[model samples]
Target: MCSGPEADFARSCVSSITSSGQRATLLTADGVRIEAARTPRTPPPAGPAGAPADDLVIVLAHGFTGALERPALRRAAAAFAQRAAVITFSFRGHGCSGGRSTVGDREVEDLAAAVRWARSLGHRRVATVGFSMGGSVVLRHAALYGQGEREGRTGAHADIVVSISAPARWYYRGTASMRRLHWVVTRPTGRLVSRLGLRTRIHDRDWDPVPLSPTDAVPLIAPTPLLVVHGDRDPYFPLDHPRMLMAAADPATTELWIEPGFGHAENAAGPELLGRIGEWVAARG
Candidate 1:
């Protein structure tokens, strides 16, 4: 949502700054290397004797062109860590991760890998919080992994899913930002600019069989709590996208939050909002 020269400069600074955490190199099931970081939860004040530490982990899936090192994502991680341990990773084709971005498709494997990693850390519960393109992936990931369909890796499923600023369907050119994004992924010159300016490597081939759309995937996420969040002023996707998702989900378990003055994804998310999201995960995940 940021624009103009000042916003550009601020974005540059935020992207350049590195986040502090325990760094690790992860390999997805498809054999792609992923750059990841884990920020341990901040221990709270002493409580009753023999009370256990927080056993929940939040796996953060950043939007397109976002990375684990970006300051905006780092800040979100820090905020969430106050309530639970946080895991942030760069999707393949972004940051130092290896592989061309399939946009949203195939990214489910990446999220699954992160969720499995969370379980390996001895966490009793795993929550997925995704933004923009990541938002769609979380929905699909929960649907795919929730049913234990992929090689019986039921361990990869998320206990809870949070999607923000995600589109409902594919090939939507409803907004200027989305139109420009399509150009960037579909044209050679635009891809070059994206590589040099955004550091995001996109795949050239189109989807063979278009994967399930976000709205269609929402219904399958039932039983496992789902939260759909969108900004009133998001330039990439409109309010209708969230509404469609909500309509597809079970009203009994799914929750929708329409942020009043929010913009888009990680860049728009601040400490207060991130803190509230963390609290929601702790209470519900």
Candidate 2:
């Protein structure tokens, strides 16, 4: 447990490790230039003489106001990298990626692009893990293109999905954090603040077609393994959100874990939890 300047330095070192990953530029179906990185897995200690190493890839989708360089994102990526190859990317409006954010609406394309890139890299299996707004993106992406079914736009589906601290529905302003987020995305003044402070360019208009809600997308992710994780004390969306997602999903294929004291998203996701998630993803492969 590092703190103060030491913690910042530690995070920077971790960020450098994540940044050392092979960088790639991915074009979404909508022609958005997405910035992505693929971190190769660290080789395990010699076990048998020539045991084949696991070839699994985990694509990480970060929350609103997050990017590939964010310390939390880097830390999570490093943890996942311990068990499998890890891919991390900034969804369009954040970091070096192009275009504006439509929140979770068009971001599904971003997640899809990252997953496809991972597949193209020759990984035998690919799993998706998302935090907050990204959580919603993974759920919708899986719904649209999971279970070996390919949509014309997004070619491949993720083999496994994990959603953390995601909202069940859109336009939810139940908590102070969410209310502030709504303001940031809805108002011009808030958008300006977001641009200057958060380095995010939010789309001016509302979602055109209104992409599927996480709960609505849940039922569609059958035969494809799904894990819905949420903090019991999450401020943005209460336990109802994960409960709603789990209820809508197929019981046989979905698993739910409501953490006791966890807060929200990547910031609250400690290394221990990330390791467990990596283990879970590895088990799937």
Candidate 3:
């Protein structure tokens, strides 16, 4: 399966399963410590025959400054668990995870670590659903790991990818919210506020070599199914971002949803919309 160093650690990592679910400490390829939790699907109501279980697992990636314990993220995880097992983790620089956030860059290794853990749990299929910053990470992860399996990149591949409220490019200052976010990540004083107020640790260093952008990554995800969901009322990124991502992807394998009244990522997603997303992943993943 996953042959990288991270996957090696994932395979060897000890996990404890309880009535609640499985919990463990994961090590990324770069030795970053990550906190992760797993929740099995909620059993359906009684019927003539019990609902057949599927081997699908969903790995959720949270937006910038978001964590597994956040109420919004917890709610989203619960909704997805209705259809399949769910894995939610705090990326490095957030929560108890060790490391600094390089924003969307290098976070792909954190996601790979989680996916390898899912495989270790014996799940036959993996679906990744990411929100905002996490959305961009999923697109890039799919491009790098979804394909090239035969070339020795295997286990970390996602069968289906769902990106919600992701941006097409980097360093976007078009929106007031984004401009403020840039300040938070770039200024020392703003970073202090982010640490004390938002509890997120951002890396101060800039990218030496820029990673692939979401639009560029989408083109390489051919044959892998992708779902891009965006909100017209989103404050961080505009409709143009989602439109560009869809345009870069293969039409035969891509699906786009532009919600009229929806706002942003997990925080803005209502129960009804989350249910629909769960259904979509269940049907295809």
Candidate 4:
């Protein structure tokens, strides 16, 4: 079922909760040291060679201030590792990764680095699966690199995206609770956190807010297929957020699936949901 026999199929998917494992090592790219845990995978056995591996090239990005070893990212990584190659990494400044996390701008670069790492290992297809702020990075990466032609499927770019409970607009979709959280993040409290040296773990330093939010980025991913899945009950990003994504995406390709009662990233995605995701990936393959 996996790329290899037993658990060896996946060397290290960022999914496991055992954060202390060797797979949690950091790799440097473009002067930035980013933490990445590798997960091995292979295609379904019934399929031909070069099929998407059981170890999907899944790059997991942590939510805001979340680290490479965040419990949620780990669990989600593990869940996806059941079918694909998984790579979970800490965004610059979050967790053990280096550099200051600049909202979603610099983080997009980090995501690119992660994807490059996965591609180097012979992965046939790659995807960015993120949560919350992590989801924003996934969208940005797809819009940026998803362009160009496929030399057959071998040279095609990895544009598959999955955002769990993410808001299209951090500025407008900000909820009462989330808005309050951002207020603290953009104010003296954030500065205090940075002064106390917690800056490396979160958005401790305030930066100029950008109008280039998800709504702006969504249009760029026209040709690439997008899968915008969210929890209808998500308190942070309402159903309207995914609706906006569907409205913006190339209706001929992009698809949106809204779960009935899922919460945020930490919640479990059982067979039903994972099955849906797996089916989508297979169809794309």
Candidate 2: list runs displaced more than 4 Å: 1-19, 45-53, 147-155
TM-score between candidate 2 and the true structure: 0.89
How well is each residue in 1-285 modelled by candidate 1, as lDDT tens digits?
222332132222222224545666677889877767778887766875432247789999999999887888888888888778899988987877777799999899889888887888788789999999999999999998888756678679999899988999999999999999999999999888887799888889999899999989999998999999898989999899999999999999999999989999999997778877877888874
Native RMSD of candidate 2 (Å): 6.2
Q: TM-score for each prediction? A: 0.89, 0.89, 0.92, 0.77
The C-alpha stretches of model 3 lying farther than 4 A from their native spots are 1-15, 47-53
lDDT of 2: 0.85
Better of 3 and 4 by lDDT: 3
Better model by lDDT, 2 or 4?
2
lDDT of 2 by residue, 1-285 (tens): 112331132232222333467877688989887778888887767675432245679999999999988999999998888788889998977877777888999898899889888888888688999999999999999888874364365446888999999999988988999999989999999999998789787889988888888999999988889999899879899999999999999999999999989999999999888888888888888
For candidate 4, the 10 contiguous residues with the lowest summed lDDT are 1-10
Candidate 3, position 56, lDDT: 92
The most accurate candidate by lDDT is 3
Which 10 consecutive positions of candidate 3 have the poorest summed lDDT?
Answer: 1-10
Prediction 4 TM-score vs. true = 0.77
lDDT of 2 at 284: 84
Clashing pairs in 2: none
RMSD of 1: 6.2
lDDT scores in order = 0.85, 0.85, 0.89, 0.65
The 10-residue segment of model 1 with minimum total lDDT is 6-15
